[model samples]
Target chain A: MRATVIHAPFDVRLEELPDPRIEGPGDAVVKVVASCICGSDLWPYRGDPPVKQPRPIGHEFVGIVQEVGFDVRTVKPGDFVVAPFVVSDGTCPHCLAGYQTACQNLVGYGQGKADGGQGEYVKLPYADGTLVATPEVPDDALVPSLLTLSDVMGTGWHAARSARVKAGDTVVVVGDGAVGLCGVLAASRMGAERVVALSRHEPRQKLAKEFGATDIISERGDAAKDAVLELTKGVGADAVLECVGTAQSMTTAFDVARPGATVGFVGVPHGVEVPISTMFRNNIGLAGGAAPCRAYLPALMADVLSGAIDPGKVFDSELPLADVAEGYAAMHERRAIKVLLRP
Target chain B: MRATVIHAPFDVRLEELPDPRIEGPGDAVVKVVASCICGSDLWPYRGDPPVKQPRPIGHEFVGIVQEVGFDVRTVKPGDFVVAPFVVSDGTCPHCLAGYQTACQNLVGYGQGKADGGQGEYVKLPYADGTLVATPEVPDDALVPSLLTLSDVMGTGWHAARSARVKAGDTVVVVGDGAVGLCGVLAASRMGAERVVALSRHEPRQKLAKEFGATDIISERGDAAKDAVLELTKGVGADAVLECVGTAQSMTTAFDVARPGATVGFVGVPHGVEVPISTMFRNNIGLAGGAAPCRAYLPALMADVLSGAIDPGKVFDSELPLADVAEGYAAMHERRAIKVLLRP
Candidate 1:
């Protein structure tokens, strides 16, 4: 089998690797049909997070099951499925509460020593809970959309749920990345009357508009807050989805929220300092973290299967597995919203 | 009128001041029977805040109505009442939502030209919303308990409500000052089965036990978190009330709380960096601030009126108005649980 591996900074290579086998009784091997580069993947590629050993590079994918271990019951060979980034037992208290990302015995796919979805074949643990099967094999075009259910889509759903987004809400999404764009779509699907996207890129902003953004604010700082405030008639947004993990983005989300509104932060907080005083005084609720991807994938897959939301639109560029390095480079330079890879 | 005034750090004086009058349509004048020193008062008195002018001191009080403006309707002259620290309009949007402390026209009782309860007579604005009437005027012994209802008791109630304390909850309260001690009472009243108080002061810890603290952790750092976790069988606390407004206190509160719990913080946050990443990852909810004093005073007053709870037990020191400076000094030096001054 062939897989993408990172040797060092800005160096990605598709090399021959041994085919993954089912090591645990609950594990299953999947022949990858499609995989995609994720924003989080850039972390190790940019030399930001030290990578002493060559590591598996992706987590988002849709594939066909090739083999299953003895204890696996829900999934079998020939089954088409989406594998969430995090693997959970599906029976833990946290997993039962729909927070599988925080499951006590959770396994992080991409960061673990275990092989991830970026390869021609990958090993998925806790197959019954980590993989959601589609009723039928999706078409070539629908593969991209189905592949997104593995991560970005589920994360966007988590953002909406954390914010308690509901009908008639004026939601403000902070970020123009794939997750941010999906957040706009999720907010709209959740019945938000208005969705505002804050972006600088022309193409991403246009895609955001198509994905249900009723307003766009290209400005940053006080100007951005003023734009959202003005759009919501000075009361600020009813729900703010912070998709960028920076102090400036979190502050903007807090500043643009109404007194009783909620700020859902799904962005992995990079260097953020949340002002506890401001949040307390305004009674604003802050909720969100790593999306319980496994918990939300089933429903998100149903939505995608029913064609209610086109989350696949986030894949602005598609390439063969051999060009995986370009995908990482493009995402690092903010040139691609998301890159889909055919295995 | 004779009142306590702080001219500078450690420079409190009992000086002659003009008697308060009904200056507005919604105003009332009360002849203060008792007033007390609060921990927050030390912020300015300790020279942490800029002081360009002599400031009237004290915000908590219980008194007898001496005069009322033309529009005052809730109470009449000669009626005994408890004045909440915050004076709100009561009809604003925020007030209607049970957040009167953030009322559009909210006013803090003292610290500027605003006269405080330390005077013989104090002016009360928005009296219809600020003062809670008692069933009858009680003897001098009941004065201390009733006075606490004005701020400390009500503040603790706000903390409990913010933390969403419920029956049988395992609660932890950080800070053993009057507010934290009162929080023990409040959480107990709210039906918590296990109440833990984090304090190093033996006297305060003893008072906390008397006020319904089932456990106490005197150690700081990892030991405190370990103590709380050990008490909860490694699950941590269901609810935590942060009553001290400092970075260290806030960190301890967060560290001691379990996943999916709420950390209610009524402390005026000072130099606290709210770590949102940990909060989101741990699924902890943050609620509380400034204690919507007026909103909870009515219920606390009822407890005092019916003798259901003796909030006045927190007043460990009492002095005449002539010794008002000593009262402030006692609280500033942490020598008093709470200081009561007779006008």
Candidate 2:
């Protein structure tokens, strides 16, 4: 089997790996049909938090179940399934409470407990809990959108949900990445009257507009905040989605939120400092993190299949599994918003 | 007239000051009927952030409106009123949005814009916005509870509201101060199935029990977190109230919160660092800040007026207005949970 591995910074490679087999009673072997590079993957790749050792990488994918252990009841061999970025035991307290990302018995793809999603096949535990099957395998054209249900789309939806976006709200999205673009779509679909996207990139801005961003601001930092405040006539945004996890992004997210509004943050924080005084003084709240994608997969998958949304447009570049390194490079170089890989 | 002023650490004195009179169209003069020492007052008294100069200090008081300017419409002379900790123009977007603390024209008591609450009289602007007048002046026994509405009781209610305390929740309160004790009351009123108070002090624990605490854990730090988890059979509390502004208190607040729970914090953060990674991993949320006390005043005042809640029990000591110095000392020395001063 061929899989992706990162030996060091700037060195992701497709390497031959032994075939994965179901090792637990609740495990299933999945033959990945599609996978992709993520902005978070760039963190380790760029040495922000450098890789310590060579390891399997990639956590988002859609696949066909090739084999299933006896205990697997929700999914079966030959079922088309979408796997959330993390696996969880279905009946754990947190999972039962709809926060599978914090499940007591949680497993991450690419870690030793589960095969990397960027491989030909993945053997994973908790099949009933982790995988969601489409009603039927749809046309090949729907693969990209369904594959997104594995992480980004659900994550974007989580940001909107966490921010408590509602009808007639003015929402601000503070990043232009695929997830941020999807957040614009989520807020708009949630009935927000105005969706504001902060983006400097022309391509990403175009996608943002298509994703239902009623306004776009090509500014950064304080200027971006000023633009948002100006757009809303100094009232600020009713809900803010902090999609980029940086100190500056987080600051702007808080700065542009109206009094009593919440900043729903889904980005993995990197050198971020929450402005406690600002949040306190303005009565603004901060919520959301490491979105529970599994909890959102069912409804989001339905949205994708029904053509209510087309988040697959976030994939501006595509590559074969063998060219995964180029896909990583293109994304890192900012040449692609997101890159989808076919196995 | 006499006013309380803080010249330095451990030095609070009631000294002669000019009598206050309305100077703005929206202004009103409030004759101090009752004022109280707050935990926040001890901040400048002990001088964590050292007081720069001698300044008037108190912000919580119940009073009778002495006079009102021509523009004052909601309150008038001879009316018994409860003044919120801060003065805000009621017509601002934030104020209209039910977040008076973040009102565009916000004025803090003792900040020169308004006379210190611990004074013979307070001349403040935005009378219609900041002062809530009762239908009629009630008996002296109701004075203490009504005074609490100016700050602590409303702050506690804000914490519960920010945490989104719903029916059937298991709530945890992280501080044993007046605000936290009031939070127990707030959570109970909101229909939490269980209200847990982390208090080691016997007096506070007793008050907590009276205020609707179903469980009391006199543990600190990790032990406290462990105790809460054990109480919930390892599931953690559904909502947590962080009423101590220290780093340790904030940490424990997050530690005891179950995944998907919100930690509603109302203490003024002094040296707090948010646990972003922990919040991200568990999907825990942090909300609430310098509570919009004015917004909550009307409802909480009704609760107090009806004798449904007696938050005034938190005041363990009382002093004449001239002995305001002793009130500060008693509160600072931990000899008094809270001290009420009669002017």
TM-score, every prediction: 0.90, 0.98
Q: DockQ of candidates 1 onward, in order?
A: 0.40, 0.84
Retained native contacts per candidate, as fractions? 0.38, 0.80
Model 1 Cα displacement at B328 (Å)? Answer: 2.3
lDDT of 2 by residue, B1-343 (tens): 9999999999998989899887989999999899999899998898878999999989999889999999999998999999999899999999999999988999988889899999889999999989999989978999999999999999999899889899999999999999999999999999999999999999999999999999999989999999998999999999999998899999999999999999999999988999999888888999998888888888888888898889899889999998999898888888999999998
- Once model 2 is optimally superposed onto the true structure by TM-score, how far is the C-alpha of residue B102 displaced, in angstroms? 1.3
Leading candidate by lDDT: 2
User: Which regions of candidate 1 are displaced past 4 Å?
Assistant: A90-98, A111-113, A133-146, A166-168, A189-193, A280-285, A306-308, B72-79, B91-93, B111-113, B134-146, B164-168, B191-193, B298-310
A1-343: candidate 1 lDDT, tens digit per residue: 9999888989989989888888889888999999999898888888888778887778888899999989988888999989887777887756776767767778776565357678899886788877888887777777888888888988887788778799998899998898999899999999999999999889988999989999999999899999987887666788889898898999999999887667888888888988777877887767778888777777788888788888999998989999999888988988888999998
How many clashes does each candidate structure show, in the order listed?
0, 0
Cα lDDT tens digits, model 2, A122-142, are: 999999999999989888999
Worst 10 residues of 2 chain A by lDDT: A108-117
Docking quality category of candidate 1 according to DockQ thresholds: acceptable
